[model samples]
Target: MDIDRYLGPGHRTAALVTSHGLAVADAAVRLAEAERIHEEKEELAGTLTRRWGTPCHLGLQTVRLRTGTEEIPEPWAGLSLRVGDVYLWQVAEQGRWVALGVADLDPDDEIQLLLVVTDTDPP
Candidate 1:
């Protein structure tokens, strides 16, 4: 996807719709960028694990999500997240990662998932 054209948001814009609302092409670009960043973080995590050892613990800082909010499992309960959306997570020591979860939030209120990093087998 022409990420630059979509995300930059200028006169040269295209119609793009999402569950959230009617977004310009820039929204798509942002999604793509988030995915790319997630991939990079995963790769970094793998490298770190290989270089170090197993059961390595990483400190999480923040996690950004497009939508949804529900309690995620371990290594993911600390970060805030939105329900029914994709999120980008960044850990202070480990790196970054992407996750999607189903959150149960009360109406008129939003709950975000927590952020944590745990070692997993590389694919």
Candidate 2:
């Protein structure tokens, strides 16, 4: 899906879940129906782990917790983080932090998206 185009500068987190066994259409249907929430999220992270090697940091927490750091960061600070919505991780390489998670493209889309972030923070 030319996912790379969605990344880089000004990009927030992104989730890219590939159905290793299912066809593209089937995967689309599953995501659209929210059929396997946990599995899809896991696969999204697993795929990234495989592609980028193990992340220097990996965690799971609520959006509130994630945004509650001493100094809230951008995209995040501007986002309307839901109270109970879960945010999966702050995966990073070196000092660059990448917020990765699965979420709906929009409130009405009912489609799960893998959030991808690649922010370079000074060491």
Candidate 3:
């Protein structure tokens, strides 16, 4: 899965795909704990349509937060993300490779959080 575009300039995005099935709410809680503003209304795009392909589900979510007037931290300081901006995260998994993307974000933007896996990994 390619996630380069969603990551803002000069910022880095990281994700972890696990074999365990994590509830959507449970993952959202983790994101909130990381200080990401979780918005559940947004529609996340991307899926495997092939008949014989593994079945994977995609979760789209956005988060907004204030960094205060103080200078933004390194890596995130120069990025375009702001207090009201919404950053996109993609959680995709078919079998065991569930991918998670995190970064500074803007509102209402579309991003691809790709997850590719085999039949062994269930959504």
Top candidate, metric TM-score = 2
lDDT of 1 by residue, 1-123 (tens): 111222221111111212222133355554564455445545654654565434333222233331134434333432232333323333335543433222223222322222222332111
Candidate 1 local Cα displacement, residue 39, angstroms:
1.7
TM-scores, all candidates, are: 0.28, 0.44, 0.22
List the global CA lDDT of all models.
0.32, 0.46, 0.30
Q: Encode model 2's per-residue lDDT on 12-110: one tens digit a residue.
A: 544354323233346466564555755665676687778666654333334336466645545444232411233333444444455454443344333
Q: Candidate 1 vs candidate 3: which has greater TM-score?
A: 1
**Per-model root-mean-square deviation over C-alphas:** 13.8, 7.3, 14.9
Consecutive 10-residue window with the lowest summed lDDT within model 2: 78-87
Query: TM-score for model 1?
Result: 0.28
Ranking by lDDT: 2, 1, 3
Q: TM-score of the candidate numbered 2?
A: 0.44
Counting clashing residue pairs in each candidate, in order, gives: 21, 7, 7
Model 3 error, position 114 (Å) = 8.6
Q: Model 1: runs farther than 4 Å from truth?
A: 1-25, 54-77, 80-123
Which regions in candidate 3 have their CA more than 4 angstroms from the true location?
3-11, 14-66, 77-107, 114-123
